[model samples]
Target: MYLTSMVFLLLGSSTSLLMALFSLYKSVGYFIEWEIISTNSNSVVMTLILDWMSLLFLGFVMLISSMVIYYSGGYMEGDSNMNRFVYLVLMFVVSMVALIISPNLISILLGWDGLGLVSYCLVIYYQNEKSGAAGMLTALSNRVGDVAILLAISLLSVYGGWNFVFYLNSICNDISMGLLSFLVVLAAMTKSAQIPFSAWLPAAMAAPTPVSALVHSSTLVTAGVYLLVRFEPAMHGSKLSQLLLLLGGTTMFMAGLGANFEYDLKKIIALSTLSQLGVMMSVLGFGLADLAFFHLLSHALFKALLFMCAGVIIHSAKDYQDIRMMGGLSKLMPLTTFYMNLANLALCGMPFMAGFYSKDLILEMAFMGSINYISFFMYVFATGLTVCYTARLVYYSITGGFNMGSLHSVNDESSLLTNPMLLLALGAVAAGAMLSWLIVPYPYVICLSGFYKMVGVICMCFSCLGGLCYYLGSFLFILNSLNYYKAVVFSGSMWFLPFLSTQNLMFQFLLNGLYLHKMGDQGWFENKGGHNLHSSLMKSSVLLEKMQDNSIKLYMMTFLFWAVVSIIIM
Candidate 1:
């Protein structure tokens, strides 16, 4: 079943890639719409848009999906429900493809909702407490994006159709367009795991590594960036774009800082994904949607390869994900080490690698743009942080001494895993240059000063040196210090973002509920609703009882008073 799926997906990928090339060469797109219903001023249609962007992204997705499924055949060996896992991943790819082809808001929701639902299933595939929690966080965080898309659909309903493509230009500068753009941006932010929404991306590493390679690296997380890219035309020059810029920069900086202090191998990669996502969003926020899309494609290729390498290592190490326990893998598994190094260098934007094409362009463009100093600092520092973490990861996992037990044996003899990785390594090596040439017709002409041109290289070189030095030095000694201890914990923990996303958010609501229980439910509501009513009823009943008990004399006096009043009226 896995082989058949892989074959079909590979075929689909090749077809899509051919179609993408043809579409790009011709500079044409085809839009197909099947009207489900049309009445008076309302219409419902199923739409599929086959453009260079959509087809090219679909090709990359299928290519990666095929590799991941093929990898999973070995990675998930002996699992009872491997078939179910493959099905869910296939569904995930289908959803992502659906989203890629649909320009209509209504049709987009169909795909958007599927991605969220299927992701929850994939995240909890392990069926454990940690997986369950991660799945919930992943589900709930994505639901925010889902709701945002739904709202955007409702807002677009007034136009007699739900196809947002038709209205982009007409609504670009309208007063209500800002609200629409805000909804779209909000949805993208949640889907891409930007800022506060980012905690779920790392938590989602509880799933199988194959799923991590597919979902986290390419399809699922990139959905938001794709959405923003599609809507960038309408959102340019809007307040929301500027806000997205700031948030993306912050997310980039934050994730890079956190990854440096992290030791978990999968999490380090996950944080790297988050940082790249921020770079994508920041580019979009800069109104360079084409550049963002370029980075998105190139990033998907290499990042997926990186995850697969991590999977092979983890499997060899008996599923231990901590880098501290891993060492000297280059001697034991030279091929996997080579592949890992290739992906790592590409991720760091080493010259002529897949990442260098898009990533270098992004940094250079940022320097040329009229961005604020904070954003400039983030771009520079985050680029450095990428190198720092990659260096740290390579040092601990590839070059450091073997820290595991002597009795353990690790090998890369499994062709099932290595073959897929070999395919992706090609992409990690060549996809960037291929994509940059294909997608970008004319090269960007930038006239930046020599100092600015060299800024990125200088920062990366220093960061790499710093990372190696820090790891070689007494890390324990530095960590044991009171001042550095707090800083390390803060940075390592992703600035307590997981706490803010789950515990802090949950606690805040719980604390508010406690206050409400004290002040409203138990205090004021009790006083005004049940307790006050009970007391008033009790007082009235007691007074009535006293009146009745005393009272033949009281009744006679009341009757005499009424008689006197009647006589006076007469």
Candidate 2:
């Protein structure tokens, strides 16, 4: 089953890539038309829906899905339900591909919902209590986002009588469809796990490593960014775009902070995924939609590599996720160490790596945009934080103090795993080198002067230096903990502070995922009006149960009476 699925995925990916390249070269638009008569007028209209953006997205889905299929075959080798896991993975990829090629709102919704369903199944593959709970949480959160999108689509179709192409055309002309744009943007923000909706991604780390890689790198979280880019024309120049920018910026900062404090390897990667998505959102919101797409590609490459490396490490370490328990692993696991470090460098946006070009493009574009100095400072600060946390990840895992009693000794023994890491490492190094040529049309000549290159080199040097200082001072030593120390100082003086407590507050809020659901539940049940409403609902539910029981008996009696009347008539 795995082999067959892998072949099918690879074939689909190759076909999609060929189509994309053909579309690009021939300048022939990719569209599929379906004619439907209006219900009232009976007038036939053809919906022309598809374009380069959709084709590009389809190509991406194909490529990544194929890679994931190959990766999972090896990753799931020892699992008891390996066949079932492979089936679910394939179904998930299929849903994503369907989403990419969907031409109408209904088709897209079906694909989106199917993806969510398959994702939930994959998340709970372990069938553990925690995994099941996490899957339910993910499902609920994703359903909320999906419902918003579905509602927006329904409204557009019902009121505007606009199909996908018609809606795109209208937006291209007006660019002020405020309500529709807001709905879509809201949906996108939630799907991407920005701000208040950000807790689900970390929770979803309860899944297997391959699922985590798929969610973080390509399939699940990228859906939101893909939607934003796909509908850019509809959303440009709207207040929603600004909202997206702010939400993205905030998510980036907060998730990076969370990554710094997290101990679980998968959770750290999950936080980093959120932070990277936030960066991409900011780029897309700022009208650098193309740059966001480029960054998306680079991020997928390196982030998947990182997750795969983490998986191997975790497997060897007997599922120990704490970096404090892992140290000097370079001796036992040279390939894992090398690939992980290389991927981390790319993640940190070190110069000459795959991430450097894309991230620098975003920064340059943001600088040129209308956002003022404060926003630029925020971007720089986020960049610094990214560097710091990523450095900490590398340092603690490979160079920190080693306590053998806390760590298990296991050999790094999988050639199947090492092969994938090698491929990703090569891509990380060489992908950026080809970016300039790959992105350009007609082989146009461009050159950077010696001075410009020097400046770029120096900026990277300073970023690395700052990251090192932060790691040594804040993370490695007690006095270096400026961010944590500042929070302590700020909260220590209030008379209510001791009663509320810093440790309790931190766990109950930040570490407890801000207790958002609790807050919502409090509002729903505890307040005066809410309490009354809950009582009313409980009473109504009892009434509903009684009515349902009575209706079932009534239906049975009616059926019996109808049967006797038929017999008499016969």
Candidate 3:
């Protein structure tokens, strides 16, 4: 089974890479459409759009998926449902590919729904209570995006077709199409877990590590940013762009702040994914779709490697996900440690690393753009918090005192895990440079001041110092003091987002749904619809039966009444 899976993965990776190269070098694209039906000038069609963007994104997705599956072979070596897990992961890959290549809304929705369903299945693969809850959150959050896409499709029907690409030029000027754009943005926000919709991304860590590596890094969360990128041509200079900028920046700041207070290993990585996602959305908001795509690809390489490395540590630590329970593994598991730190450095946008090429470039361009001071502060602080949390994570998990039990044994597991990490590590290190050259053929002309150029460096330095202070401050005094308790609770709990998205928001919807069922469907329809008609018919039937059962007295009374009326008229 594993061998067959490997063959399939390798074939997919090679094919996508080849197509990406061909599309890039030849500057060619293919858009194929099949008309299924037509009525009143509207057509229902299936479409496949293969261009350099789609091909390149597809290649990265397939490559990461390949590494994840191979890593899972060892990670799930003896699990009884390993075969089922592999199948679900493959289904997820297919769904993402479908989404990447399609230009039509209907076809995109098919892939969109496929990703949501398959992810739900994968999230609940463990078949336990916590997994079940997490799966529900993941499914429901994504369903919002699904419903938005459906609405977009319904709106597109009036345009005579479901293909959005052909309509991008006119959509900005037309008020009707503006709603379509809004729905698309809302869908992307939910899918990408921006702000209020973000609680689910961290909750979804209940799944196994390989799944985490796959879902968080490329396929699921990145789908929204990719959608927005495709829709960006219409969104530029519009109110939607400003709204996206606000929400994206806030989400970036929120996630980075929350990660510092979080201790769960997987959750930290998940929050980082959220932060990076916000960065991509912010760039898209800045009308830099190409840069957003660049970051997306580069981020996938390192983020996936980061998760796999975490998996190795968690597996060896007997599934202890708390960073406080782990420390000083650099000597015991040197290889995993090395790859993890590399990924971390890349995440922190260290000079010349994968993240540096994309993330740093984004900050530079943001400075070049005409953005507000609020946005400027968000970009700077979010960048710093990213480094701060990363440093804290590395210190707590790798370089600190040994905190695990004496009986615990930690070491580099096997070639199955190491080989995949090594492959992704290579990509994590080099993908940024390669993608920059290919995707961004021309260099961005920046005319920033010296202060702006040094902002990123300054942020990293101050953030590093803050991280160091926290690392040593734990012993000196109260790190999380009573004065900061309120702040900690707010940020630590994701600003109470889990409560808001689930208990608060959904609870109202549930009540309304139940009320509709009782009053609208059952009560109102019973009294005013079929039930009312039935009662009126039954009453008329009873009156007729009583009149028909008339006796001699009844006939006499009727005759007397008619005679009296006739006399009065006379």
Q: By TM-score, who's the top model here?
A: 3
Q: What lDDT would each prediction earn against the true structure?
A: 0.91, 0.72, 0.91
Backbone clash count for every predicted candidate, in the order shown: 0, 2, 0
User: Which portions of model 2 miss their true places by more than 4 Å?
Assistant: 34-51, 158-162, 172-176, 400-409, 433-460, 473-570
lDDT of 2 by residue, 25-88 (tens): 6777757666676577565554434555566566656565556666676777888898888778
Candidate 1 Cα outliers beyond 4 Å, as residue runs: 37-43, 475-481, 507-570
What is the Cα-based lDDT of residue 313 in candidate 1? 95
How far residue 262's Cα lies from its native spot in candidate 1, in Å, is 0.6
User: For each candidate, C-alpha RMSD in Å?
Assistant: 6.6, 10.8, 3.6
- Model 1, position 46, has a per-residue lDDT of 84
Indicate whether candidate 2 or candidate 3 has the larger TM-score.
3
Which consecutive 10 residues in model 3 have the weakest lDDT in total? 474-483
